[model samples]
Target: MSTLIAIAITTGILSGLWGWVAVSLGLLSWAGFLGCTTYFASPTDGLKGIGLSIATNLSGVFWAMVIIKLSSMVSLEIIGYVITAIVAFFMCAQAKKNWLNFIPGTFIGSCATFASNGNWQLVIPSLILGVVFAYAMKTSGLWLKEKLEADKLVEVRKN
Candidate 1:
C-alpha cells in the first residue's frame, strides 16, 4: 500500500510536469494529452479534478452522459479520457498566449476535482499535494538557475 501510494505521488508529480510543459508550449491538443496522461498515470486524488474539468468543458451534457455510461460498461478508466477531452475543449476555447499561466487552470482544476469527487478526504489531500508539487517545481527551478549561475562564475574565474 505504501509503495502504491508512493508511485501515485510520483506519477502525480510527473503528470504536473507534463501538464506544465504542454501548457507552456501552448498546444491545446497536447494539454489534453497531458491531462489524460496525468489521469491515467496515477491512481490518485488528481483524477477527481481531471474528471470535473472534462465534464465542464465538453461540448454538451449529452456527450458527458455518453462518456459516463460507456465508462461504466467498459471500465472506470474511460472516465479519465472523458474528463481530459472536456479539459482540452475548454483550453482550446481560451487559447491564451501564455499557456503556463497556471493560476486559472489550477484553481479551476482543483475546484472541479473537489466538486466531482465530493469526498472531503480525497479532495483535501489532492489540494495539499497539488500545492506542494507546484511549489516544489518553483523551488527546483530557482535552484537550477542558481546552480547554473555558480557554474558560470567558476568557469569565468578559471578562464
Candidate 2:
C-alpha cells in the first residue's frame, strides 16, 4: 500500500475511535480533532511535534483563562479586547521557547478553550488525547507502509 493510503486508513479509523471515546466520556470530540489536526500540521514530527502541540495548546488555555478572569474583574467592554491583544502578544512571543514555537497550536487551543467556555477540564484532556491519537495514527501508518514495502521486496527477490 502507498504511504498516503496507509496514513489515511489510520487517520480514519482513529478518528472514529476518538469520536466514540469522546462521546462516551462526555467530552467534545471536535476539540480533540482540533488537537489532532494541530499535531499533524506542526512543523516538526515525532516527539517534537507532540511537545510543541501540547505546550502551545496548554499555553493557549492558560492565556484564555487569564482573559476570562481579567474580563470578569472589569466592566469595560474594551478591556476584553485589550486583554486579548496583550495575551496574543505573549502567545506569539512565547515562540522563543523551542517547545512552544507552534503559534498556530496556541491559537487553536485558545479557540477551543473559548468555544468550551473556558472549560479547561474538558479542553485539556480532549486536546491531549487528540495529540496522542495523531501520534498513533502517524506511527502505525508508517509501520504499515514499511511492512508492505518489505513484503513486496521479498516477493521481488523470490521472482
Candidate 3:
C-alpha cells in the first residue's frame, strides 16, 4: 500500500479513538484536532515536528493570554486589536529561533486559546495530546506500510 493510504487509514482510526478518549477525559476534542493538524503541518517530521508543534502552540497560548490581559486592562476596543497586532509581531518575530519557526503552529495555538476563552488548563493538555496522536498516527501508518510491503515481498519470493 502507498504511504498516503496508510497515513489516511491511521488518521481516520486515530481520530475516532481520540474523540472517544477526549470526551471521556472531559477534554476539548477540537483543541486536540488543532494540535494534530499543527503536527502534520510542521516543517519537519518525527521528534522535531513534535517539539515544534508543542513549542509553537504553547507560545501562541502565551501570546493570546497577553493579548487578553492587556486588552482587558483598557476600555478601548482598539486596544485589544492593537495588543493582538503587537503580539502577532512577536509571534512571527520569534521564528528566528529554529524550534519556534513554525509561524502557523503559533497562530493555531493562539486561535485555540482564544477559542477556549484562554482556558489554559484544558487547552494545554488537549493540544499536547493531539501532538501525541499525530506522532502515533504517522509512526504507525509508516510501520503498517512497511509491514505490508514486507509481506508482499515474502509472498512474491514464495511464488
Tell me the lDDT of candidate 1: 0.43
Per-model clash counts, in order, read: 2, 0, 0
Q: State which candidate has the highest lDDT.
A: 3
Relative to the unseen true structure, what is the Cα RMSD of model 2?
1.0
Local accuracy of candidate 1 as per-residue lDDT tens digits, 24-86: 654332324423433333323343544433332232223334444555665568676877577
What would the TM-score be for candidate 2 when compared with the true structure? 0.96
Better of 2 and 3 by lDDT: 3
C-alpha local distance difference test of each model: 0.43, 0.93, 0.95
Model 1 worst lDDT window (10 residues):
55-64
Clashes of 3: 0
Q: Which residue segments of model 3 deviate by more than 4 Å?
A: none
| Candidate 3 lowest-lDDT run of ten | 78-87
lDDT ranking, high to low: 3, 2, 1
List model 2 lDDT by residue over 8-113, tens digit each.
Answer: 9989998999999999999889999999988999999999889889988999899889988998888998988998899899999999988888999999999999
Worst 10 residues of 2 by lDDT: 63-72
